[model samples]
Target: MAGLDFEPALAAALTRHVQGITSVGKLTRLSGGASQETFAFDAHTASGTLPLILRRAPGGSRDGGSGQGTALATEARAITAARACGVKAPEVVYVLTPQDGVGDGYVMERVEGETLARKILRDKEFDAVRPKLAYQCGQAMAQIHQADASQVPELRLVTGPQQLAEYYERYRAYDLPKPVFEMAFAWLKPRIKEPKRTVMVHGDFRHGNIMISPKTGLAAVLDWEIVHRGDPLEDLSWICINAWRFGVTGKVVGGFGDVPEMLAGYRDAGGDAYTVEDVRTWEVMGSLKWGIMCMGMYEVFRTGYDRSVERAAIGRRSSENEIDLVNLLIG
Candidate 1:
């Protein structure tokens, strides 16, 4: 799988399954996404060269991660369903089969945009698009939520209380005490409630998972690995988590726009009515969720399960989420 050696197997798959794909060119694995592997390459088709991305499990395993995510095929189906609902999700070109020999993953159109949270927030190039991203995110979430459940992949049904308990249990197992996490947990426990109706919730609908186009604002929503059926407010509140706002905490929505505007866009796009207070509750949960995730990641580092510096660095950010929880729950 070094250099261009990975091309032949992938090329064979694409040529056999993907229409017009004659061969592949320069398949390069992209960095980041620890749980999954991503590769960028060109499909030298009969008509033109096409840029596409292959996302798969780390070692071609059918089920990636420790039961944290759905199958790659399921993720691909969710993307297709989202796109069908008018959400700006990547177009799924092909789902890799075991016979393909590439891995357990799918091929999607390479969306052109910035996915880095800090770069999209601070870069001068994205300055013009910053102000509108939150609203666009709202619109996209609305479309995703409106998708027919029957049409999309079978997703796990997750409730707010269910998630809170799961994360809290994980935190307890870690045995690393944080007063902020404790306080956030106590504050969130009583408030967490299931919605009257459920919709497709993009479990991690934050800055990094969203693609931003300088000219068009929000491009496509990426990473549906943990997507599930839940309250739409979960998606709404997740973007408002202070950690996603980066250093620009004032904007309150992905470091770009205000909550009112985000809500306006959501409601305008046929999303259910939700108050700012509603979003605030879920925001608290989202902060607590992220804090626990950071802790779990740090646990990996602590146990030498993953000795990567990245794991340790992300573990250090748990305190940041603590501050966010304090601001939301205590302030």
Candidate 2:
């Protein structure tokens, strides 16, 4: 609040567009992400004080995060697509452009739910729904995968082969040697088939991105920056990736349940038919994909892009993905 460069601009934008908002109060800079900055505040409106969250790309451009640094409007439009398919997505209230003087970003209605991955996995308060969380995730994913993405023109439709090749190229540029990643890539290249069942995928639909309720289980899916048209099985397998298991390796699906329960939920929710082999392939691919990203992040740290302890530590996580890739591909 004391020295933030965007505070005055933010106030101006809110005053101009945010209707009936007497003022914004208790504004807090939540997270300083490289691609976008997130903030939470209360809008003192005429009716009532509404809680809201803002996602803004610092300095008017994206940097230091997932995807090719997609624009905030793309994410907002993707969320709208997901919600149209009955997925519980947060409603976007306003999108801020450069003309608004707040940079590029969007404001969303603050939802009431818990997003902590570990707490959802182990906390006793979630005991009733923890066992059912995996299936719930499957049902939610089915809705997302079935969502008509063609409605959102801003989204880029991509195929598996395209992204996989890009990942390999990115990894090579790092000049870091990873045998497991190499072998996994070698195994995946030929197996990559034309996606038989394509849908709009929630690219990063892991535990942390999901919002859960103690009474109802899955509440909403957050983070749409990387969403694109791809194999729906990729979404299914990405959730099952061991890296997102949060230390409880026994329960493969985000430390909550197994494949059968999730598949059953998917079927109940009308997701397209897919094979176990296809899912296994994507699961392995997800591990490799994450490993490549982890190593890439390490390079970012090594190069002093952000130079935080967290960024430096993320590279070490590549080993976890490597181990997972070995178990999936070789075993």
Give the count of colliding residue pairs in each prediction: 0, 0
The ten-residue window of minimal lDDT in model 2 covers 60-69
lDDT of each: 0.85, 0.82
lDDT tens per residue, model 1, 53-128: 9888875666543577877787888788888889988899999998888778899999898989889988899988
lDDT score for residue 180 of model 2: 89
| Candidate 1 positional error at 211, Å | 1.3
Model 2 deviation from native, Cα RMSD in Å: 2.3
- lDDT (10s digit) by residue, model 2, range 121-175: 8889999998888788888899998887777665666777887898999999999
For model 2, the stretches where C-alpha displacement exceeds 4 angstroms are: 2-12, 15-20, 59-67
